[model samples]
Target chain A: MIDIHNLDIDMGRARVVSNLTARFETGRLHAIIGPNGAGKTSLLKAVCGLLPSATGAIRLDGHDLTALSLRERARLMAYLPQERAIAWDLKAIEVVALGCADLSGEDSLKHAQQQLEVMGLSDKAETSVFSLSGGQRARVLLARLLATEAKIYCLDEPLTALDPAWQRRVLEVFKSRAAQGRTIIVSLHDIGLAAQFADDLWVLDHGRLVANGEPEAALSDEVLRQVFNITGTFAEGRNLRIDPQALPEHGA
Target chain B: MRVKSLSLAGGLLISGLVLMGALLIVGDVPLSGADYIEAITHPQSLNGEIVWGIRLPRNLCAWGVGAMLGVAGAVMQGLLRNPLAEPGILGVSSGAGLGASVAIVLGVGLVPFAVEASALLVSLMMSAVLMAFVARFPDRQALILLGVGISSLCGALMALVFNLSPSPVTTTEILGWLMGSVENRSWQDAALCVAGLAVAVGLVPRLRAGLRLLTLGEETAQSMGVNIRHVTLIGVITASVLAGLSVAVAGIIGFVGLAAPHFVRALGLRDPYGVIWPSGLAGGVMVLMADGLIRVMPASGDIRLGVLTSLIGAPLFALIAYKSAKSWA
Candidate 1:
């Protein structure tokens, strides 16, 4: 479980995440959804200790996050950033092996190959990442994240640039990981997907956490209308779909 | 992969030694086979003195300086994630040149190793400024721009020193040093180069893992628990020391650092961690071959080592740029 209390993140003088308090339970897939400039990425970055200006308490299980060393933090949680530019012609297997840094050389490669197999990239293991398509590169990065085997996974916009089938496949992978008792927090832009796959949802507006609960209740009509400036019809089960509509004149 | 890289390095080192041996017999006074054998056996003979005191130290100095620059260049490129990044591009060589110029123009020889000490001190200061800028910005383009700015400033200061030189002799000496040469180098200069190479070799273990992780970019490396700042600091300092010592001993040898790693990459060692040793060896071989070309050339005046390296390296650099442009296009 991860706990964040009164967390505030500042970039320069502007507050990107202000007074945000939330608790993410183990064995759950939590999705954060917000409009543009809604602080979804900032909140995720702060939780992963990437933002040095973040203030307030962040605890994992019972230990304070700030008290852990970087390696220790990394061993407990893995992060996949939105930017996907790799610097060299590194082989896909080598890129995945980087996440298994604590393992022995042969074992790291073995585990990396296994993860690649899981992502259906076993054939591309020896291929350079520079030559992979945008979607394939995203899958390679996701394989790198999975190879970490961390207790908590923080992925920012993992579905971007992925096809619809691959997006659903990735969400299913996260769901299975959550079933195995890992805490998975993913920030997503697709409202229908978030409502369908997420166990719980956290909605942000500007810099505040406006709603937090099950996806059906957290993404309430008023919350959608005010925060997302869109209308959505919510229902039970897996039949929830957000219909596209014209925006109001004055906005939310 | 590791075996391939090691074998490549060993091959290059042996090739360099063979070239050095062949060039040992081609100086101004031609040596017969018997004379070469006698020169090797008798240290006090005239031929012995020419071989040991003159040619050997000069060849060793070239090899050592080239190796240092090559390793430094590999580290700089890996750290900056730029194929074109090298010590010269980072203003380290120019900074060292400015230091050497100051010592020469002001005649600050009261202290031993004054020129080397000044060169190292100034280059380290340049690295510090660079590290500070990176901390604030953490952008590759900004870092390159700052390096160019620093290089321009150092170039202006060097020119000012040249204009204010005490005498024509001083001006000539500074100009000769800036042009880069291994002529008349002594055993002490060779030993200094060896020491600098040793320091760079010692830094490999510390830099290897971080550099490999950095292939995924800085943010990802940091997330993987690699301390990017610590790695960057060590890389910059190591490159500065190596480049500074090379400049202090052999003036401003250009392009060895830039070309050696590219050559290694072309040889199929794409891992940045595995590229360092082979790059150094490739650099030594390159310098030895260039020096041999200088010896065999039928020109009236000696061809400057820096001039030859630039002539070779600039074209390779342009080809790399053109390829990158085409890929982007």
Candidate 2:
């Protein structure tokens, strides 16, 4: 669904994302994973066309992403940044409705409302998003992305501040959406969640793409040791277990 | 909700007509309701030229200018994402005031519209330059500091112009404009203000989406498909023009711009369309009512619009700000 080629995002003098090439096919959940300072978020932003590529091309469904207008891109793909603090006192449902702000009519409103309910936010429909707990607010925003009818959902750390049960629920929602032929690319901090939910993974370190493939291959001990400077085993049992083989990623 | 809309529309129309009528009926030789009607029908039958020709046009001009100031103030607060923002804060008004002051001292009274337009244009350019400067900084404090610096610079230049003028009449006239009055405006001035107001009203709806996103701060707005630079420019230009036209007509009316929109917002006028129109209406009503008070009450020299507004608007503003602070947080 998306192709990123030789992407290098330069912020000031430093390159946030080094030359990177990747394809995100339709109908699967792909996770971008790495330690702190990784260019995972930058890669997601570049792919979603939020940032101007310092030196590369991002294509969505064979269309040059940079050439597409905002409305066109917004219609085909949805983006949820890591931070979701709203300044206005908009209702949870109204916040979701903003995803389809360009569109007006009963059908769009109904669809948005349904998406809010799917995120288990129907009871909080009229509640101000600011009044809701952090996890609930994230769910409200997720519903907004779901309401877009966009082919791809680019989420940068959708799991932050979510409780463990809510985290599982959100990951399941992404899995189900991918099963229904939507592309989900998420920047995740939780390695276990990435392995549990992602059909494919891209591991980044120091602005460079270190590994990309099946979750098992990308999260392998060798790649973990090299990219994260820590050795860990990915044990496939009881909902994707993680064996903490390293005392610490760095010297204690 | 529909009731609120209807009541709002009804209130605006009623208040506009009543205030216009009151303006017509009051003067040194007060006209009765019948006399006021006759004066409109038969212009030559007026008691004094100042009553029909001067006072009427001036009243209309004041009404229009007041509305424009209020709308500009509301939009600036929204655009800058700060409740305390006003046209005066960004030096747009001061810049425009300087341009008008230059024209006044240089004797360009014939095409008041042209003068107003030039003022608006200059102010808009200054705001654009300031916005460009502001873009270099990540912090809001930087933008405010830059604006304050520009305002002070303009204020100094304005003071110099008043000081250097050959006659006291120039200084007096500039002070009158700065104090803001609806005393003796001509029909041509009324036409100018109306034209400016029409342009602003037409522009507001097209920029509503961008304005909505802007409240989220620039980065967030950009993430939501808003082109920040274009929207900010549109808002700044539109606001500058409105405020410039207001200053050109009325001198330096204060507090209407600062207090009127916020008053309406504190009354739960959050939607852009309602905020624009009601703020305008509130501006008109507030200025006219204050003008009426200045005319009728107390044995005194001409009480300036600016003084009365800061007197009334400042307290009302403080109250509203206190109430809304927690909501914004």
Candidate 3:
């Protein structure tokens, strides 16, 4: 379980996230959904220990993460940024192997290869990441995250450029990881996708946590209108479809 | 793949040794293969003194400078995640040149060891300044742009020093040093290059893992347990030392740092760790070959080592630019 209390993140020029308090239960997929500049990414960054919060205690299993060394904290949590930053044309397997920064043994290679197989990227293991398609690149980076095998994962918009097929595939992978008792917190933009796959949703509006509960209750029309200002009907189907009629234009 | 790269590094090492041997035999005082063998076997011969005093030191200077630049280039590229992140491009080399010019103008170079000491000091200072500037923006385009600005500033300062020279002789001496020559370099110069090489070799194993993580970018590497600031500082200082030491020894030899790692990568070494040693070996060979080629050529005036390197390096740099233009865009 991950718990964040009074987490406020300042981004040099302005505060991106403020007074955010939440507890993310273990063994579930929790999605952070918000409008643009809602501080979804900032909250995740603070919790993952990437961004230092002005006032907050991020505890993992009741242990304060700030008290732990970076190495120890890395063992407990992993973060995947939104950017697809494969700067070099390293082989796919090599890219995955980078996740084991603390481990230096023959076992690291085996673990990386196994994670690649889990992501269904085993065949392209010898290929360079620069040549992979956008969706495939996303999966390769996901494989890097899985190779960490950390207890908690903070993924920011992991499905940004992925297609529908890959979206379902990655969601299934996340579900399987959650089933194995790993806590996964992902910041997502697609409300319908979050509704279908996320076990819980934390809705944010301008850096404030407006709703936090099961996806079905938290993603209702009233919350959507208030948080996103979009009046919509939440229709459940093969894909959770949000049929928007109009925007309630009080203010964004 | 590791085996293949190791073998390539071995091949490069052997080629460098062969070039060094050939260079020893074919200088102004030409000696036969058998005569050269006799000079090696008979240490008391006059040829032995010539070989040890002149030929060996000069060759070692070239080899060591090449290795330093190559390794430093690889580290800078890996740290900054920019293919064009050589010391020359980032203003470190020009900063060293400025230091050397200061030493010359002040007649401090007449004092043994002061030239390289001052050059290394100024080079590191300039590198720290650029790194501090880079930290403010910490983006790809911003880094290259800042580097260009710093390099131009240093180049202009060097020109100003030249213009302010009190005598034509001083101007000529400064110009000759700027041309980058290893000719008539003594053992003391070679020792400085060797020292830089030893430091780089010592740091490579530790830097390998950090550089590998760094290639993924600062935020991601920090998440993976890498202290990005520590790695960046070490990497930049080491690269500056390497470039400064080389400049102190061989003048401003360009493009070896930029080209050596690219050559290694093109030869199928993708891992940053895998690229380090091979790139060093390739760099040594490049400078050795360039120096040897100049010695062998029957030119009217002595061809400058820096000129030949830039002659080859400039075109190769253009090719790299053309190929990687899309990525920059």
Candidate 4:
């Protein structure tokens, strides 16, 4: 379980994430949804120990986050940022091997290879990372994260450049991992995709969490209009869907 | 990763030895293969002194300088995380060149022991100064700019030395040293190169964690338990020492360090430590071959070692750049 309380972050006088408090337990998929200037990515970065917060307490199973060493935090939560720039022509297998450095022996390699197979990247084992396409590189790096086998997975803008098929595939992978008792937190932009898949949604507007709950409750029309200022209607589906209508004729 | 690829380093070692043997073989004093064999076996003879003192020392100097430059270049590129980066990119080599040039023109006896030491000192001082300048900068791009500025300053100073040399002999000597040459190198010179290379290679693996983590970025590496400042300081200093030592012995040979590691990386070697030895061996062979080309060239004036290496290194750099450019697009 991860719990953050009243977190205030300052990066050179800019509050990327301000006074945000949230709780995330294992065995669930939590998506952070927000407008353009929202601090969704910053919030996740703070949780993963990549960014330090100025005020508040972050606890992992009741222990303070500050007390944890980087290697320890890395073991507890694996993070994959939005953009990846691997500057070398490292083989796919070697790239995956890096994720297992904290582990030991055949167990690590075997587990990593298994994760690669699970991600459908086993065939490209010896290929260089530079040889992979955008989607493929994402999956390959995602496979690297899987190899870590951490209790929590924190990701930022993972679906940005992915095609719809990849978007679905990646979401399904996240669902399976969450189902297996791993906590997954992702910052996503596609509201409809968020509506269709996320177990819980936290909406942010300008560095503050505006609403937090199930997709139905959190992405309601009133909250969307008040926080995002979008004149959109929420539709009932398996999950909440936004049926955004055209601007009223009189407005022109 | 392949065992065969690793053995290429071993092959390079053998080739360096053979080149050394051949360097002894085809000098101005033409000795038959059997006669050359007899010189080592019969040490009391005058041929023994010439073979042991003149040719063998030169061969060792070539091997040492090559290895030092190769390893130094590898470490620098890895530390900076930029392939175009070298010890001289921070003005270490150019500073060494300046020191050596000043010594030559002013009739300062840089001679056997003092020249290499003085050159090493000047280069080390310049690297330290660059580090101080870099520390004030918050980003990698800014630090790189400082390095370029320092390099430009050193280059201008180097050009000034050439312009002011009173005699043609003094000018030619400075040009040869600055352009990179291993002529008339004594055992003392080879020892300096060997010592610097040994220290650099020995110290690189300790910085392996920092080096591997550095690829992630400075803040990331620091966040991962690496003391970024210390690791960078040690890495650059060791690199500067090796590069300075190379220049002290063979002038300013370029490319072996840049090319060998790139070739090894291209062949799929991943571990930084694994690349160090092979790159060193490859560097030695590359330099020996370039030097050998000069000896065998039917030209009137001596073709400089630095010129030949740039001839080799510059093309390989272009190919790498072109390949990376296409792939990135």
Q: Which candidate should be chosen as best, given DockQ against the real structure?
A: 3
lDDT leader: 1
Q: Report the C-alpha lDDT of model 3 over B247-282, residue by residue, as the tens digit.
A: 988889989999999999998887776787888889
Which segments of candidate 2 are over 4 A away from where they belong?
A: A237-245, A248-252, B1-7, B48-51, B104-146, B162-172, B215-224, B272-274, B320-329
Indicate the worst ten consecutive residues by lDDT in candidate 2 chain A. A238-247
CA RMSD for every model? 2.2, 3.3, 2.6, 3.3
**How good is the docking of model 3, as DockQ?**
0.74
- Fnat measured on candidate 1: 0.60
Top of the candidates by TM-score:
1
Worst ten in a row by lDDT for model 4 chain A: A243-252
Ranking by TM-score: 1, 3, 2, 4
lDDT of 2 by residue, A1-252 (tens): 898898899888888889899999999999999988798888877877777646798899999988988768777888887777665566676667767766775665677889988888888988877689988988988888787778898898998888999898999998999999999999998887888788998999889988989887787767766666666665655244545566455532
lDDT of each: 0.86, 0.76, 0.83, 0.76
Interface RMSD values for all candidates: 1.0, 2.5, 1.0, 3.1
Clashes of each: 0, 3, 0, 0
Colliding pairs, model 3: none
Candidate 2 TM-score versus the reference: 0.89
lDDT of 2 by residue, B1-329 (tens): 23564577568758976897777666666666677667667778754465568777867877787888888887777777766788787777788788777777777745546556556666767777776774554344665677688789889989998988868887787776677666767787788689878878777776777776554445545657777666666666667778777776676788788887776766665544357678888888888888777778774246777777778888876877787786657
Per-candidate interface DockQ score: 0.71, 0.35, 0.74, 0.31
User: Could you tell me the lDDT of residue B76 within candidate 2?
Assistant: 75
Pull out the clashing pairs in model 4: none
